[model samples]
Target: MPTGVALHDVRGQLFDAAERVLVREGPSALTSRAVTLEAGCAKGVLHRHFADFDDFLAELVRDRVARIDGHAAALRESAGTGTVTDNLTRVLPDLFDPVAVAVVSLVTSRDGLRARLREARPVGVPILTDAATAIASYLTAERELGRIAEDADVGTLAPTLIGAAHMLFADRQGVPPEAEDIGKVVNAVIAGVR
Candidate 1:
């Protein structure tokens, strides 16, 4: 008999497990065995769902990236409500959460994973690229509402903010940056535009 789970939603269970492994041990530790162990499922559980380890990783990345759409919508909805700095400060950490940073490392370190991801995300790194686009869209909304300067270069500003937040959050291992630190960076990035 096969040793594994017959649980519903196994893909979600495995993805969550992989994120835990990524945050706790970084990308090098994210093997299918490690993920199954973290998930408390048998090793073959992963192989059953995915063609291979890289396929699982690519799907994991895509699932996370798809979440950015929801975030982007929420951020855009807040365009006229909060201060631009406050809105951005709140969203940056969400965008650069520990799992996301680890995913970036995973994508960069594994060429096979990168190649697999490129079919859907051909331009930039997976999570970060989608995040930058989300930020840009939010900033554009704010600009249209007269919250940010009409002259604000949202295209340029979005990536700059993402890059800065990525640096701050990426250095902490599994720990997140303080809200104060994130606020400072957000304030600085939007200062010229506001």
Candidate 2:
């Protein structure tokens, strides 16, 4: 940021900056001041745009959750271009990125933040739940095309796969699960039911 230069905030810029701060420095480092500094804007910019820091943080979490939902729902984007397993394996990685992991950790540990988020979205759609639902819908579509077994229990399998994914990468101390690891898990889950 050049001295005295006015930098306009593009939508999501502050959110991206906050995510970066969380990933690099941890949740305690994510203040509105830090985000504005990272975003190269005035400190008051965040307050001006949002009711307060909690509202802004909730929005960021909401945005990431929505992004995950969008990504899960876009399973068809790879339809016909790759095997069903391949498409699902690709989408699975989006759930375990460092930024997302940090956000999840931060939100779950803070009751106030959690309450703010729930208030912001009254329907109380958990991101993981939405991801599982979207994954099931995709699997159902594939099953319709004979990719999955007709008797496959999609409802049970969806969350099982998602839960497996969460366990594999949600651990902060371990090395993040690689694509091969995710592929093995996805294959096993699909094979057991499909």
Candidate 3:
């Protein structure tokens, strides 16, 4: 086994490699062996960092949720300056990234994995809900500022837009929307709010 890096660094690398594996090969390819190999670490490295596959999976979900939450928070902070459509367009792609989609796909999959994923639900839900709230708040502020349609139902509309963004990428058979397509959707939603 090769070793030189600090334990925390090694652990971080393994988690990042796990995300790549999950995104590129789906949840089935997320074994400790695969992650260690991808990270160029010794076999025991994964064991040292994670209790077992279940713990590793939970951490992966947690990390992804944290990343999404951070990104959403950043978007909310910058939202005030952009047009409502601009703000939605900026944040939409982050929702559709391969890692994020893979996490959701894994959660909806069969028995054992689904059960393990359920254990992380309490961790994941609030992150997403907070993201939704940030989006809704941005829209509400825009509406108040006379930038968005005065009558726009910011509450329902914001989440629906976020859901649609996720659906575009999650639907495997369907073509995902491009930036322009997303802009169109945001525009339509705004129009409806008007």
Q: What are the models' TM-scores? A: 0.94, 0.83, 0.78
Worst 10 residues of 2 by lDDT: 1-10
Per-residue alpha-carbon lDDT of model 3 for 1-194, expressed as tens digits?
57875566765788888878877788667777888888888878787778876677677767777786667667667655857677788787776676777777665553565567666454434334545676887777777777767877878887777777776777543566788988887787677664
Decide which is better by lDDT, 1 or 2: 1
For candidate 3, which ten residues in a row score worst on lDDT? 120-129
Ranking by TM-score: 1, 2, 3
Model 3 residue 61 CA deviation (Å) reads 1.3
lDDT of 3 at 25: 82
lDDT of 1 by residue, 42-98 (tens): 888889889999999999998988888888999989998968888888888888877
Query: How much lDDT does each candidate structure score?
Result: 0.88, 0.78, 0.71
Q: Highest TM-score: which candidate?
A: 1
